[model samples]
Target: MPGRSRPIDKFAAAVGKCSKESAVYGKCILADYNNVHKDKCAAEFMKLKDCYLAAYKKR
Candidate 1:
């Protein structure tokens, strides 16, 4: 039998949102998910991370 497909992670979903909001930041992070690119979108990513963490804490 085929294995189940897991749902997308919060960070990835956040990245998608960032992409929609800012094409440049989106492309940068998507191309390279390392410290350098992450620093470029630190603010946006931080918001997403906080939101994800909050939701997780509630759960």
Candidate 2:
């Protein structure tokens, strides 16, 4: 794992590749997710996780 990227770095890099506003929105949503309802948060997290996987695949 010497050269492997950390998940946070991968996430930030992926978000960084997005439009500024969208990246900010995504970051904000992630940051505030803990305060949201568990079910809703889990749903949103799954959606974002899928997006992250898609981005990773493209990379």
Candidate number with greatest lDDT: 2
Write the residue-wise lDDT of candidate 2 on 1-59 in tens digits: 79887778877776655554465446767787768554645555565666666666665
How far is 18's C-alpha from truth in model 2 (Å)? 5.8
Question: Which lDDT tens digits does candidate 1 get at residues 1-59?
Answer: 36643345544554444433465445657766665632687776666566655554443
Clashing pairs in 1: none
Candidate 2 residue 10 C-alpha distance from true site, Å: 5.2
**TM-score, cand. 1 vs. native:** 0.40
In every candidate, how many clashes are there? 0, 0
Model 1 C-alpha lDDT versus the unseen true structure: 0.55
